[model samples]
Target: MTVSPLVWTLTVALILGMLVYDFVFHARKPHVPTMRESAIWSAAYVGIALVFGLVVLALWGGDFAGQYYAGYITEKALSVDNLFVFLIILATFRVPRQYQEEVLLFGIAFSLIARTGLIFVGAGLINQFAWVFYIFAVILLATAGSTLKEALKGDEEEEGDSRFIKLIRRIFHTSDEYDGNKLFTHLNGRRVMTPMLLVMIAIGGTDLLFALDSIPAIFGLTQEVYLVFTAVAFSLLGLKQLYFLIDGLLDRLIYLSYGLSAILGFIAVKLFLHALHENNLPFINGGEHVTVFEITTSLSLSVIIGILVVTVLASLYSPRGRAMSVVSATEMLSERYLQLPADATDSQRDAISRKLARQLQRMPRISDSLKDELISDRRHYMELLHEVHGEHLDYLSARQSSDDTSSAESAELERRKTAFSDIVNPAAESVGSAEESVGSTAPEGSSEGRPQHH
Candidate 1:
């Protein structure tokens, strides 16, 4: 498939423009995005990707279009899987909700650069060496096995940092605390790295590892480097928005890991088959054409879409998903309500109040009276926090005034000491000089004769 330079330039320009708009409008300010805001932007991005796919379908033949869609869907599924790790990383870092978007945006940007390099290298290798597919297939198979093991164990939390993060901590003086989304901060007059920076590094490293699987999986579906790159790019474009849109919903998708593992396993088999068909190694089938059943792009695309739809539906209806959804919802609501600023805007307060009311109304397990009481208790908590904050300010002011008074008194004492020293030193010297002069003039042999009479 031949793509014109003009098309490439246009695509790059458009993607760059969207990124600029995203930074300027969505991520420019630090705020927890509203459900409505997240939904709109996420839908917009998905819509844009679908429209671009349609354009590809019209320009290229159905075969190429099928390849693009297959690659896009596969990459999209992988990206969602990537989201879980991102969530784990964010939670581990205890990143502030407002700053989460900024961190995600930064991670996405870094991954784009790193993944682009990987894409080129992978493309080059595949073009040069047919046996490279075997390596990609083996890696994907191993990843799928590992993913299946973890999924079956039902372990949700990614407990600790990777080797990359550990190395970063060991080599750099990193703070355990976040400095309001800043990657670097000054401590005791020395600049130090913050957990945010380490989190970004970990995120980048994690994505790079995922690329090992994803790059090969997409290549298996389509050999065209352009399709692979665009599919990956389009899939990643709005991931930041999707992260917020499904922040809690993501936790409820308990079966997603299994679905992803299955997809990876299927793709790995496909890659292995493709490698055998294009065998160049002398040992493999004596360099003969090992004809095998080739998987069609349409079938691959259908299977991927079908798996995703079923996984999503089953996850939502599953017992665990239902139980955890409510628990997670309540936890998030309680946390958000408590952290609501005392000086929050009227609209902000009203929004929270309405959200709480809706949740209470929807929740069947909790009583209406209890919900009402809970809401009132949150209000009381806010008031208490405000009162405490005022008192803290007053105490600080009082301490500062006491310090100022003490400093002034200390200055006055120092001045008195200086004056006393100036007068006393001179007088003592003068007295000593007078005594010396008197003894020298009148005393010598006369004093000795007078002492005999005494």
Candidate 2:
């Protein structure tokens, strides 16, 4: 008797137990999670999955363990690739950093249920008919086609309702605005579902579409339902953690599709082979098991690790092109901050942030004091720049002119003020980087760190 079912049940229980731990105790009493917190938690989540995989292998003999792990690795890699789109979705909504956690957690929760349903249906299909492999293979290839389009396609002229979303909206009335990550609520004294629910629904639905690729790909590796589900579940459980950790890094992995495409191509071939093995075709039916190159569980494990490492390194070390992508992203974020009008979503904002980050990066090289001064008064400097026109800045000296001030102390204060006159409007920068600020230089002026009143 195969122990697959029991093993998977226990594995699922363990997963839910951890998730419950996080929900009840761990994620509860937090001063908001910082980048540091994101990094730590992400590492912990991945580490748990890895260590857990080893335990699965140890307890269930080598074969089932391999099947489970191979499936898991494939799912995890696909999940990471899925995050690039999440980055876009979040940016589109302009989700706040603090509230982003709630968004992703909600998304992950709904996705787990949806994917579980998809997996069960898929397993049932495979059990019932041999021709289902062809259906599965076609869906996977189609998904790969769509994914390639998403990866390679440039900005669309506009966003539209997805077919599924449009259909849902057509059938039922839904509200447009978010209700603080609340899925459903009352509006205008009537019960209404929130866009937050729609967004989660969109995400969960898209993942189901993606499952068309992922489920079939893993099924190529294992016929065991328990192994299949265990791997898919484990992979998904880590997604919210990954989203928190890597939202900033998404743009860097610009070539993520190439990697994913290679993975898909690899799986597509595997599915074709598995189809060949089980088919009733005249020549191949009852034919001997044709061994392809030795692709073992250990190799798949190593391949997964290698792919993740290389993708990350390639992204970080690739050309510094992420600047505009991130800035473009910054512009898309309008839901939370109405800092910019719709038109301000241009390349200028991206350039400014990139320039500022680069300046901060180069601070040590120029002069530590200069660096500190630049950073410490960043907001103040932005403000001054905002107040003065280009011509006005041109008139000021390296220090505010002594004549420009009414008193000696005032002159000193004015100088300080000039140092920071460039600073203004932090809230405004949220929607998009204003072009006026990106390249605007401070006027040369004699200045003190204090502000001098005009």
Clashes of each: 0, 28
Q: Write model 2 residue lDDT over 232-258, tens digit each, in one string.
A: 877877677677676556655766675
Residues 1-454 of candidate 1: C-alpha lDDT, one tens digit per residue:
8899999899888887887788888777988888899999999988998888888889888899899989988898899888988988987777878988888888778777777898899989999999999999998899889899998876654633777678878988888888987889988888899988888887877877788778888888999878888888888889999999998788678788888888889889999999999998999889886999888988889888888888898889865566456545644654555565656564664455445444433444534343342333433333322222222233223434464557766565445334433432232222234343223221211222111110
**Local error of candidate 1 at residue 90 (angstroms):** 1.3
* Global Cα lDDT for candidate 1: 0.73
Q: Rate the local accuracy (lDDT) of all candidates.
A: 0.73, 0.58
**Number of the top TM-score candidate:** 1
